[model samples]
Target: MLDKRRNSNSKERIDLINRFIGLFGKQVIQSVAADREFVGKNRLAFLNRNEIRYYIRIRNNFKVFLPQKNKEIKASHLFNCFKTNQFVYYNKIVRINEQLCYLSGCKLNSKNIKQDFLIIVSFNKPENAQEEYQKRWQIEMYFKAMKSSVFDIEKTYLQDIQRIEKLILLVMIAFILCYKIGIYLHQINPITIKKHGRKAEVFLNMG
Candidate 1:
């Protein structure tokens, strides 16, 4: 019983560490965890630690809150919560790089003052974020294919609950079939196909 309890505690500690590692990269994780100041603050403020200074930007939705805080505080403050909270620093005016440009114009809603200002946050490590964001797209694509193509989810002629359950089962089976076929095709070797083609050619020549 004691051994089992120890193992459970160990696993819990490891899970906590891993969660920190995921939020802040391994190098920063130890520093962030050891820093009591960061841990004590609100989790939303701690999210800023996940971002690097050079890669920080804020959205236009944040502009209203900005004026209420500090004028000199830059968009970087959104991702630098420690600085923002400590110094009461809010907005920092930054020059947009003309060479590394973003869209200059945005359509603003006349009724909403918030919609008028749009802030673009560019990251120095865009490639890192790009791959992670692409994984989300792949997941969305799979869900779309499952719902529309394999499942025929929209063609639900069944109004009854029991009939709806049957439709769901049919859709699941279709999705599994498609997934298995895709896996099998991906495993096939081009070299084996080429070798078979050569053997067939030789057989034809002999014939």
Candidate 2:
């Protein structure tokens, strides 16, 4: 757990993760995916230097230097003519923070118009970025289940960093167990798909 006073940016989080995994010298990470909060020039450069594959989403207005164009352009500008739900994968890679990366962009047909653009920068397989980024939503759903529906963790109102870490660790343990049980339960009897296009709830609730 990070101290409350410490202001952690993408670099710090990535460094922390790298350090943790460094203990296992031969560990191999398939790829890393993160929201815009973790997207920055230094962070991207660091990942590139380490040859770490990544799919980091960026805001529509993020500027990248296009070598072909010999200028910086907002991500959305490259796909300005794209229709809703239309995805564009640039043939040539671009430079952001002087790090070479590919870009895959989409104009999502979501209710929130302002945030419709889903732009992802990656070290490879830009065409697969949009779909890969969708999996992050599943992680968000799990956190929501812990913080509200299932564990109600927010009510604890933790302040001390050590106490918060302990609480989060316990919650994480429960979450892992419940998620595993949920998977097993689903294998026995599939979950019912509700009208909202998702299973009624995590199968753990059925257990």
Q: lDDT per prediction? A: 0.37, 0.81
Name the weakest run of 10 consecutive residues (lDDT summed) in model 1.
32-41
Q: What is candidate 2's lDDT per residue for 97-152, written digit by digit as tens? A: 78899999878777764756888999998888878878788788778777766788
Once fitted onto the true fold, the runs of candidate 2 whose alpha carbons sit more than 4 angstroms away are 5-7, 25-27, 112-115, 203-207
* Candidate 1 lDDT, 59-131, residue by residue in tens: 4333222333434343333434332112222223332321121111123234654333223322233323323
Instruction: Tell me each candidate's TM-score.
Output: 0.31, 0.87
Error of model 2, residue 181, in angstroms: 0.7
Residue 166 local lDDT, model 2: 93
Q: Which stretches of model 1 miss by more than 4 angstroms? A: 1-128, 160-166, 189-207
lDDT score at residue 69, model 2, on the 0-100 scale: 78
Best by lDDT: 2
Measured by TM-score, how close is model 2 to the native structure?
A: 0.87
Worst 10-residue lDDT window, candidate 2 = 198-207
